[model samples]
Target: MLQPLPQEQTIMAETDRISQLPADIVDNILGFLPIEDAAKTVVLSTNWGGIWPNLTQLCFAPHFFRRLKNRYSTKHAAFYVITKILLQHQGPTIRKFEVDYYDSKTETVKSRSYDIDQWLLLVTRKGVEEIKLHLGSQEYRLPDCVLSCRTLKSLDLDSLLVRPLRSTYMLPNVASLRFRSINLDFFSDLVLDVPSLENLSCEECYEMFHLHIIAKSICSLNIRYCSGRELDSFIPVNMDLRSIRTLHLDSHSLQNFVDDCSRTGLPLRSPALNVEDLNLSDFCFKEETQASPLIRLLHICPNLIKLHISLWCPVTWRCDSTYDDEKDIPSVAEVDRRLPELRSVAQRHKRLVTLKLILFKGFWCEMLFIKELLAALPSLQEVIIGHSNDMDSKRKCEVMERVLHFPRASTEANVTCI
Candidate 1:
């Protein structure tokens, strides 16, 4: 083999290595870029010209069109660019398609509904697996084609209206479903039939008067800031989550379920017996009434191995008077009386190994709660404590020292305070 001359070697070193990459690798790189940036690569070199048309993922985010020349409005620009790309795309399959239009006006959404429907129709025909649509707070009825798309594996919708579906429509392959700020028609029972769904999340959604989830394959469920039409007439959430393993319920949703159960004389303990990890946010132990619901929720998950509790600090915790030693610290007997339900539940949770407490203020109530948890959980191996930002350096140090001295049920338990 003969070595090249110095001039030839220098020329070889300056060659466009990225442009010379294999077709599949180049397609992947283009797929990760914003549609606009990826489209621009077509002019870079002849090798990249065909790569943009074969991109498997297309994302038309608001910021992508925001940088365009102001010849047209953002909405119109997005419409033109996305339509052009889809029309030019030669890919055999689209793995993901996302349209996030947060700045859409109500009239704009209504006017563009037909365009969105066409987009969905084209993408569904190309076997799109994941579809995410964030069409602002307006209610745009999704095209019927999306409901019957068998190739869809994940569907995320925000601010849309779901009308009653025909019995023939089903999402047979969807494994993950997410909804935010959606309005559901009374006859729509779409969620009840997703047999392959494994993860379900609903956030800030309302007007679900009779939400029933009956997914047997679901492993994770998250509900946050969700409510029904009328509190007095709202029906309780009915779920058949026998296979659920991880659960998250915010304060409002949990309280609503508890209240509904109480009113209907239904058991507060759910059928989510397989849940091993539980996360409760905005939880407060300041009132005795609050303890009952927490206890009932724990009872629903006997196999829980990890527990995360974010204590809701009231205005009283920030007052200067709350720092007084005599007034702030409760006696041992008082602590037991105030938190008897928690103690009972903690004793029964022998399988629990990890405990996380967030927004800890080191008040006497919180300290006693920590002490009770430390004494009760014999299998607890890790304890993570996140102190509130309101605490001063001196106060944090004092709290850490106090926690370090607490007796642990597990000899190997490691405690970390931050």
Candidate 2:
């Protein structure tokens, strides 16, 4: 008999050890892999053949459907695969299910809508706890069974027009809710009655005229890019965020909403005042010279422990003293113009300890703004300055120098750059 090689002997021993593991242990190992990789295990060994059907989590994303380019091919292939998987699944409960059917073809989306809904119904009925669906551009009305699923703990909808069956939805157990690139018109019907929701985010949604989020159980609320210039004049977005502890808002939307509240005497409640952290971004100081919307947030979030802000400043303000509008750097005279507005709001920030500034371009106006912030927030202990990746090493060094030397109202404040 030919002598067995040492390597071959070791391989056989390892395979035997793995094969001896408990079925549940093997299933747990497979669960850690992506759904696509896990499916390949069926051919690896007999132990995996029955395992796929009992997987607790299923994630069939668009990355696996890349080969089927056109509408018909993807729709047919995805439908057959998902249907077969769900039909063959033997588990009594699925913990999580996520699908992204974002094809460009409108007809393909329409063709697969019913199949997707059926799959959702099947899993949700099986006591799935988390469901995330990202559909194409067309309007895909969600089934009533999914909207009313009491077992669902989390729901995420993206890039689809959601038309609930009824005027109001009551998801009693859902705690985390997110909507991205959705029609904001549905917020009234969708979010009104979700009593257990604690975290909510509406980002990049369109056509938002009025926001009426009044859920008292919410602890974190993020409203970004939804409130814009096109809001209908009659209904101002009413934000009732009394119970929230974390808040993130785009500067322009916050300014617009605040102005509207001021005009109508609508008492814009300082929800950020109660929050532990606040993030304000996506506003250019050049656009407005009035009370800095960002500074206003720092002042109001008195309980805040962390603060993040992103500002647009001129590159030449740090590199060259001469203001060149030709180089996109408004004159230093313009910086002088906005200094008083920034200074007017500069005051003691008693609770802030950590400050993070994103996209530091080293403009003089930004320099003055940082100076004012340092002069105000007395409790600040750490300042993190992050510059854009496009910035060169020399420019990064310059920006670091500017931040390090700025006078600090807090004696222990330290500055670091990234």
Candidate 3:
């Protein structure tokens, strides 16, 4: 038999190259493309056709529908495309499923709510492990199937309304959960029955009167910008966080958490003994207030090894105050009056090894606070001071000099300014 010519051989090799690749590699390559584009690959070759149906991850983004021709309405086109893909998917278990639906008109989303529910039902049956639904401004009610999915390991939701569960729903395998800009008004007391959950985050969510988290295995919890209906009222979070090792809270959430502890008198009974890392942002230290929440957290997390605090400074300084005066350090009498509680808390936190202060303005109050901290924490090994962008070189130098000269309780402590 005569072999093919060199030129002919090259053509055959190029044609067979893609088909010869492993099925997992082909699936990964198709996974990067949008669901519509990945589905269209079926027409490329017989091998490609067989490969796309087994893709484990499917993402139906906004561009998936926007690229279609104007034969059908946007909502209709989206519904048709998603249904076709889910129906044709032959994978044993879809690992991840994401839908980012957005329309300028809110009525469009409302009209297609049923279709969205159907898509979720199909995916849930296929054993999807992760689901991310980012429905734009409109409030779409989540289907009951999603909440009860046993195979789900992660859930992320945004701009949706969560209704109260009729029966006790437990996500046995879910480990990570996140909510952004969600409305929980109808849910008077939201109970998270995730036994295996390890990480939980809530950002900019509102109208949650009470949150009852039953995640005994949770290790990290983050709450930022969450609030209640009334201006002064705050959402109370109730959980047995004895297993938690990391805690992050902004000013709003911290105040709410502190208030909840005070109202229930739980702080005195149970402190966060396992927490090793604590991050607090936008914390205000007023001169008149005798008790400080920052100090309260230090007391709660007694075993903390790392602490990050971002001081919240007022937009406008007092008219009588001078910003450039380096010698304007507060007297010892005044410093004691302002930060009386902090001194006691600092002395008790001997295990704290790292201290980071963000938005350091070298103000009199801030300097005094730093001085007290340096003199108290005997195990502190590193101190990082972050200054504002508008601070001049001269001002930064002045602040650094003062921080270095302040008496240190830990001989190994090194202070750096940036």
Clash count of each predicted structure: 0, 0, 0
TM-score of 3: 0.79
- How many clashes show up in model 1? 0
The local distance difference test score of each candidate is 0.75, 0.70, 0.75
Off by over 4 Å in 1: 1-29, 40-46, 69-74, 165-168, 186-192, 212-214, 230-239, 257-272, 319-338
User: How many Å off is the CA of 214 in candidate 1?
Assistant: 4.3
**Model 2: CA > 4 A from native:** 1-32, 41-49, 67-75, 186-191, 209-214, 227-240, 257-272, 289-291, 313-347
Query: Of the candidates numbered 1 and 2, which has the greater TM-score value?
Result: 1
Per-residue lDDT of model 1, residues 1-418, tens digit only: 9999999987876786777889788777877777777778767988777777788889887777666525564556677678888888888988899988766467767877778888999999999999999888555888878878999999998987767566445678889989888764443454456778899888887765545554667888887787765765233244545577988887776766557655766555543367899898887665455555677777767789999988775755542222235454554355457566777677778789999999988776677678878987788999999988988888888777988899988897899998
Give one digit per residue, the lDDT tens place, for model 2 in 201-222.
8888765654454366678877
Which ten contiguous residues of candidate 1 have the minimum total lDDT?
319-328
Error of 1 at 180 (Å): 0.7
Residue-wise C-alpha lDDT for candidate 3, range 1-418, written one tens digit per residue: 9999999999998987987778788777877788877778756767676777788889878777666525564567777777787888787878789988776667766777888898889889989999999887545888889988999999998887778566457899999988888875655555668889898888888765555556777888888888776633343344566777988888767766666556655563225547888888886564333126666667787888998988766757532233235345554355556565777778777789999999877665677778888998888999998987656788778777878898988999989888
Worst 10 residues of 3 by lDDT: 318-327
Estimate the TM-score of every prediction: 0.84, 0.81, 0.79
Q: What lDDT score is found at residue 134 in candidate 3?
A: 86
Pick out the ten consecutive residues of candidate 2 with the lowest summed lDDT.
Answer: 317-326
